[model samples]
Target: MLFTSSSSEKEILSIISKQLLLGSTDARHPFRFVNLCTLDGNQPDSRYVVLREFKEDLALFFYTDSRSEKVAQINKNPNAALLFYHPIERCQVKIGGKAQIITNTELIKEHWNNVQTEAKKGYQSVLAPKTAVSQPEEGWVQELKYQSKNFSIIKVRAKQIECLQLDDEGHLRIGFNKKQEVWQSTWLVP
Candidate 1:
């Protein structure tokens, strides 16, 4: 287990922050892909999103097409949840936050420039995501470009974070909440 009963809340938070930061840069990290849940009307919509960046202020960013359904959902309801789990470590982290579409032109350009050439096709598709097409290839662009207007970033500012670590002895859980720019943590029953 990464944490134990004797672990302090600060230590656990540090570990989680470190892991998340590492996940942002390491493609193979378990936290690299997260389950992002957003409200679609009264129902919950969940999908896997790559962890493109993690800020020290508890903000996480991911790339998506501007015309994707998720962008529409976030526009209607900004509240969202993110789930990260490592099967081998038997640890899970759940984050509740508010999501916003990043509109800063420079920020979007920076991220778009970093996207690999081969992966750029996803954003350069001729048709918007989820568009109906008779053939699968019809949805894709016939000619690839270095960039597309559909490239966008979604930022999630975490309000509450809960971590659970499974151990043979017993499970350990902790909760962290941010208010007024300060963070408060507490041990939770598991």
Candidate 2:
């Protein structure tokens, strides 16, 4: 079956808000994703990260070190892509946007202050992501604390979004593009 559904970028954006506010029933927020792509230094890089937060028509947040390569890559290339999926629901969401490193000290504190010790453990890694080094080992973290000062948040102001509905009947694609501060979506053959 070719399932067809479309919405204004803002409306579909609302769909995400509905999901995020629906308590733990929403698995989209926790899925590990591999979609932030960077073109820097002659080579493109990407990585998997937890989906942190989103504001309508504005920015999406994910945490990383100010010193990480991804951070540096974003500096070189602000364009990036985001992929979201649910195994049981069989739904996928794509977000394409220009990224800006969050620089507001207050915003950093607000986001960091909410980070629990467990979540903060991620920032304590000794090995920088995508770095090649000696034998890989774990448990070198000195401590687990909500230290947000050293971390930088990546904010993507989405310019386009492509939602793919994957099921038995091949797949269905929904495309949304942002123009003049408005979102437009169309059905495309998948």
Candidate 3:
């Protein structure tokens, strides 16, 4: 287990922050790809999204096409959740937060500039995600585009974070809730 039963809350929080920061830049990190959950009316919608950025303030950011169904869902309801797991470490981190589509043109442009040439195709698709297509290729852009108007950033401001460490001895579960800009930690039943 990454954390033991006697591990302090600060230690766990530090580990989580470091792992998330590393995930944003390390392609091979297990946390690089996370399951993002959003609400589609009464149903839950989920998909894998790359961890684009992890801010010092504990905000998580992901890139997506502005026209995608997830974008619509987020617009209707900002509440969302993210799950990250490290199989080798037997650690799972769950985050509950509010999501907001970043609309500032300058911020979007800055992030867009950082996207690799080949990776930009995801946002440049002629057809939006989840659109019905006869062939898989029909959803892709015929010509490579330098800039994509559909590129957008989804930022999740975490309200609560929970970490679970699995071990033969005993599983350790801890939770951190943000209240008035302060994070209060508590031990939870595993």
Give the TM-score (vs. native) of candidate 2. Answer: 0.78
Q: Which 10 successive residues of model 1 have the least lDDT summed?
A: 139-148
lDDT of 2 by residue, 50-118 (tens): 557756444667888787888887888888877766566576767788888989999888888777777
Weakest ten-residue segment in model 3 by summed lDDT: 139-148
Off by over 4 Å in 3: none
lDDT of 2 at 19: 46
Scored against the true structure, residue 29 in model 3 reaches a CA lDDT of 97
- The model with the greater lDDT, 2 or 3, is 3
- Candidate 1 Cα outliers beyond 4 Å, as residue runs: none
lDDT of 3 by residue, 86-156 (tens): 99999999999999999999999999999998888787777778889998878875446567598999999
For candidate 3, the clash count comes to: 0
**Each prediction's Cα lDDT score?**
0.91, 0.68, 0.92
Q: Which ten residues in a row have the lowest lDDT in candidate 2?
A: 19-28
- Candidate 1 vs 2: which has more lDDT: 1
User: Could you give the C-alpha RMSD of every candidate to the true structure, in order shown?
Assistant: 1.1, 3.7, 1.0
Error of 2 at 123 (Å): 2.4
